[model samples]
Target: MKKFFTILGILILVLVFVGTAVFLFNKSKEKPVVYETSSPFITDIIQKTVATGKVIPRKEVNVTSQVSGVVDQLFVDAGDTVAKGDIIAKISLAPNMIALNNAESQLESAKISLSNAERELERQKNLKAQRLVSESEYNKFLLDFELKKERVKSAENNLLLIREGSTLQSDLVSNIIKATSDGMILQIPNKEGAFIVESSTFGSGTTVATLADMNDMIFEGMVDEAEVGKIREGMELLLDIGALDSEPFQAELEYISPKGQQDQGTIKFQIRAAVKLQDQVFLRANYSANADIVLDKREQVLAINEGNLIFEEGAHFVDVETAPQQFERRQVETGLSDGINIEIVSGLVESDKIKQL
Candidate 1:
């Protein structure tokens, strides 16, 4: 019985040793991973931030009425070019009958008093000349006559204002709204009879017309807060309008919002750039566009495909191809990158070959 038990133990130990040997043999035979490589070359490296917004004129005016009245006639239509003081619309006075009648009655009463004073003045003058009245009494009557004449003139002027909106004679037109500047009428919200309200502290009021100089076009976009600090005013910009195809338009950075706004949980800053549009190309206000403000640019920079770079433990590394199917690790000092290619400011010249994967 003891001999049989000892044989079973020996068999189990042999089987364990065979399994361990097979596992070690398979692990040692495993193949090394093959990596792809690419060589560094001279290329342009441009860095920019993309923003989505609309195309608007640099100078736009919302022509509004200063006085509230019924719109009688519209002289200019949309797309019409208007000069300063050009009549854009006309407002007919909605006469206030009660106020007009009250003013007229006051003027008539003042005139009647003026007539009585004039007669008294005449009588006093004649009496004084004939030595029939005292000089002090005649002087007092003359002063009252002159005061009554002034009061009648004031009453008449007030009557004219209530009836005609202005005291000027020669049948002056009422509320002829004119353009404040020379610009193209982009929009005429009020047609022939659209009533527009005057701009007040409460709001901008109803916009009568939208005028803009189409020649002065600009691109408005937003930059991510992460990149807003790197941009500044007067930086050259390249604008790629989706409607204009791949041909990028040129512009200059004009403004960067000082305050940050949260959008989709990501903070972003607003940026505006003045774009120089072609004379023939007409750009409407609020046209969507993408802008690239080049923070830094290089003509012919030593660059490599960004894919060739490898990251490990907070350090940047790359695989350089030494021979066919052979690669070695290389540390690179990089400069600005356009997100697709990386600029090699130092380390790894054009002669070095790099792996893409």
Candidate 2:
């Protein structure tokens, strides 16, 4: 019985060893990896980088109140087209009590002074007409009376301006906020009765509305800091607005911020590109967009898939096909690369076949 058990265990060991040997031998005999071969082809290569941003009007004007007041009435809303000097909003003046009191007091004092001057002028005229006073003396009284009258008028205007936002001289254009340029209303941040701060030499005021020429739009976005050096102003850009998914818009690079901002563990630089408007297609302001900025371009050049090129010690080389299924290392000068295909500057021709790595 022990001999029978031993024989069975030996047979099992022999079967396992034979199976392992057969598996190992078959794996070793498997075919090696074979990459495809292709020759250089004539094609256009465009090297570009993408910047994510939004579509904005090239010129956006913020309409702010000249006086601290409440937005009493809004003349227009978003999407309303306005001409230059068109009223956008009306601001109700929030007059200061102290300033108003001072202006009124100043006006009253001027009125009293004017009355006294007029009475003195009457007496001086009588004396001059009867030849009791010299002509020079009468002229002095007349000049003083005129000056006092002018001061009274100025004080009255000043008082009126403090009480209301406008005087008699500016009643038509008073606290009515007008558009500085012709454009469509993009936004109305303040509603009726919303309190607002005045824009003064002291501080920036609250914006009542935002206006922009929708025809003159732009793509404002940011790019990674690593790709900024390859771009410059006036480069053509392909802008893809997230809102308008029909076709990509064309833009021209215009602004690149000198400073870089850190975001999500990476540095990005701001960029602005003017969008080229198309007919019958309206591009709303602040619509999100992505810009494809071309860094370089090669037209009708001999190029190959970038994967086939190998970089060694800063020099690029490709495997040129010597014969079927055989290749030889050949140094090649490269030019514009759009990441997928690269321009082969030298060491390869359109007819010379190259093997892929």
Candidate 3:
């Protein structure tokens, strides 16, 4: 019985030892989490927002006809430079036989009326010299003769204009469409024989061509209402034209619309920026571009990757690896952040290491 009790006691000790060994093996099998660390360095931090828009000229104009007629000639084509008062196109007057005949008849009648008024005035003057006519009668005859002459001149001028597009006394023609400013012809829709309708107050008629001053290009974009307040006139911007696939260009904010547009339950305001071109880059009208507005820029700032930061209890902190398997929670003073990286004002140095959790 003593031997059996001793054996039982040894069995109990062996069981306890096996249990402890199993527990330690299971604990050792657990996966250990690894951490990444980086050192803070002085860098440039720029906070920016992207906006999509197009490259437009500072001034663009659509040249249209003033009268409806067949296009007789196209004086300029696309890419041609034109000056103010330069004729862009000419329109042929359509058949309006009735109107033309009436104008002609009216002119002839006015000439006859003027001749009769002159003869009557001469007779009145002679009668007045012999004291046969009153002074008021002679004055009335002289006034009537002068008024009739003016009417004859006006009628003849109108008739000449209706027949030949212009009169000897007039400088303008209804059929000739001229440029209002010095610019390049961006488009010419109507060919030499295409018919065009004139623009009227009631409606916008056919557009003959588009004229634009390509020398001055502007970047037009929109900013969300939430970000519009952060943007203002005179702010510098970086522009990227997707089509060019080249380097970004520089621009300055020039205009911001006071009103906002409601789209998809979000408000956006229109903005215009003047981009000075280098080497006269060919920027077609409405070319797609992205404007990057730099809201903040800082140089030589101590910054770290934003992934290393931890926000807790209204304080920004980071895990610092002081030694092997040792880490400490440290609070840091931060300034401007550039989304990907944050500016660290204090509580960290370039030589110190940061653990990303």
Model 2 Cα lDDT, one tens digit per residue, 1-357: 999999999999999999999999998896976868888999999888999988877788998888888888998989899999989988888887898899889999999999999999999999998999999999999999999999998998888776677767665645789998999998898899999998889887999889988888778899999999999999999987776757888889999999999989999999998888888688887788879998887799989999999899999999888887788899999988888998988899888988877
User: lDDT of each structure?
Assistant: 0.81, 0.88, 0.88
Error of 2 at 244 (Å): 2.1
Across 13-115, the per-residue lDDT of candidate 1 in tens digits comes to 9989998999999988969777665678898888877777788988899988765667888888999999998998887655568877888898899999999
TM-score for each candidate, following the candidate numbering: 0.76, 0.76, 0.81
Model 3 TM-score, all chains together:
0.81
Task: Please estimate how well model 1 matches the true structure, expressed as its whole-model Cα lDDT.
Answer: 0.81
**CA shift of 118, model 1, Å:** 2.7
Instruction: Say which candidate scores most in TM-score.
Output: 3
From the highest TM-score down, the ranking of the candidates is 3, 1, 2
Better of 1 and 2 by lDDT: 2
- Candidate 1 residue runs with Cα over 4 Å from true position: 1-37, 133-154, 169-174, 198-205, 312-317, 328-331, 346-353
Point out the worst 10-residue segment of candidate 1 by lDDT.
Answer: 165-174
